[model samples]
Target: MAIRDQSYQRYDGPVRTGRSWPVIGWSEFRAYWRFWRTKLTIFAVWLLPLMYALLVLVEAALMEPGQLGADGPGHSHLNLFVSTQLFALALVYIARGCGIVSDDLRHGTLQLYFSKPIDRIDYMAGKFYTLVLLGVVSVFAPAVLLAGLRTAFFVQSDMLAEIVVLHLQTLVLLAIAIALLAAVVLGLSSLTRRTGWAVLGWIAILIVPLIVHAVGAVAADISPWDRLLSLHGLVGLAGDALMGGADAMPEWMPRIVPFAAIGALIGAGFAALNWRLSHLEKIT
Candidate 1:
């Protein structure tokens, strides 16, 4: 026979205090992985990077020193690598990251979140870091692979040091790109309650100059080939400047311009995110 023992017990648990945004960030990150769409998208994004790695392998195996356009730093493969970063990440952001803030607003969850042990900074940081992680997966991971492959393949030559320098240069470039893209999307996500609208807004901002060029709002001189004002072009320009390849950059688009423009865009992103969060705080 089982006897029921009834007694009053004091509740005891570790008090959750201090900055707790990581709690929010970590939970959100886990939830994102649970979605099948995220799994499929991640799988698809890796294919291009692996395919590009084939070129590196082929050059090392068969081609002459300069046969496969191997003149620039790391044979200009890193430059080509940068061009592949944006498109796949854009799909992931649209599928899920674009909803980072809008979903909370749509579901009326901010009040509930505020009821817990976190504030807006924590919320923003968590959300910001989530997108940055996605950027790492979509951009930096593949880059490191290529960097290592190049380093290993060219270990016997003077190009080893140059390869290391190029990798370091790209580290800076990738950081700027990952952070800027995350901020821009997160900031835009805060502006509306519909993820679809947020996605459209992000896409528009990223390619605004192209839309302008198409409608003649931009000068004819700023046609497709000469445009450097867009986000994608600015990133490429910054890479060129950092990697000592800015000689080909146009006179109008000075090297300093991309640095200044990237800074301004990053600032603008956080400002927009903060503004929306402040509005939510007032209401909550």
Candidate 2:
């Protein structure tokens, strides 16, 4: 029988400081972007904005000077663009986020992640940022760029102020939508070990409420506040409000309801994710 010394020896290698979440985020971002399918989806989403920009340019060249006012044609176009971007956000969230956490769990990598230098929050943040990056690229960035292009080339001088205000509103709305949706998807991802189940959960959470809301809207008289049960309806209402549309919501419905609903959703998502990870950590 032989026993060898197992004394600790500190290596002279350079130590990295600061939170590693950003590094984790960047690494995940690059890895996802490397996939051909992801790249194709992003390109396809961007093409929608590009096509709309071309239409705007053609309309600007052919139309009369006063045909498009600040809040008339321009506002309509902006709303359409925002709606398209939101749709793209949903697709990207489902495609890219479905596997983020579930893959780690299914592959038995959760223990490996927990053994690293980062905490659960950092791990979650890292995975969440990947979806955020996709949203910014596929939805937010294109919308802002198209709006700036339209403002610069087509919008009139007198209407620039109004257009700028609308643009700012669009920016804020898009940011809120992206953050809330990312939180919801990531939370769902953390709950399941199978990617397909996570994807199905996301679809159920997003779609089931819409069906209920629609049936309620049709079969029974429901208050505007009742629409908060539908996540899609709440976001649509918020978007309408941002665009100053008349159909935003009934005056009886408080303006804060949409914000509150989205906030609650995001809170529940993160709470579920944290609880799952904490229990997993204890068991591992």
Pairs that collide in candidate 2 are: none
For model 1, residues 1-284, the per-residue Cα lDDT tens digits are 33456665688978867887777777887799899888788888888888878987987889665543356454255655675676677777877799988888888888998888687789888888888887787677887887788778777665678878888788778888888788888888888889889999978876676677676644455453434567777777788777866675665567887888888888887898789877875546
Give TM per candidate. 0.86, 0.86
Local lDDT at 19 for model 1? 86
- Candidate lDDT values, in order: 0.77, 0.77
Residue 145 lDDT (model 1): 86
Model 2: what TM-score? 0.86
Predicted candidate 2, C-alpha RMSD: 4.4
Candidate 1 CA-lDDT value: 0.77
Model 1 Cα shift for residue 62 (angstroms): 0.9
Indicate the residue-level lDDT of 283 in model 2: 41
lDDT of 2 by residue, 1-284 (tens): 33455756789899887777777778888988888888888888889889988987887787677666534534555555666687787777677777877887888877887788888778878877887888888888988887788778644557777777888888888888888888888888888889999999988977797777788789998666655776566676777666766555677776677888889988887887788888895545
RMSD of 1: 3.7
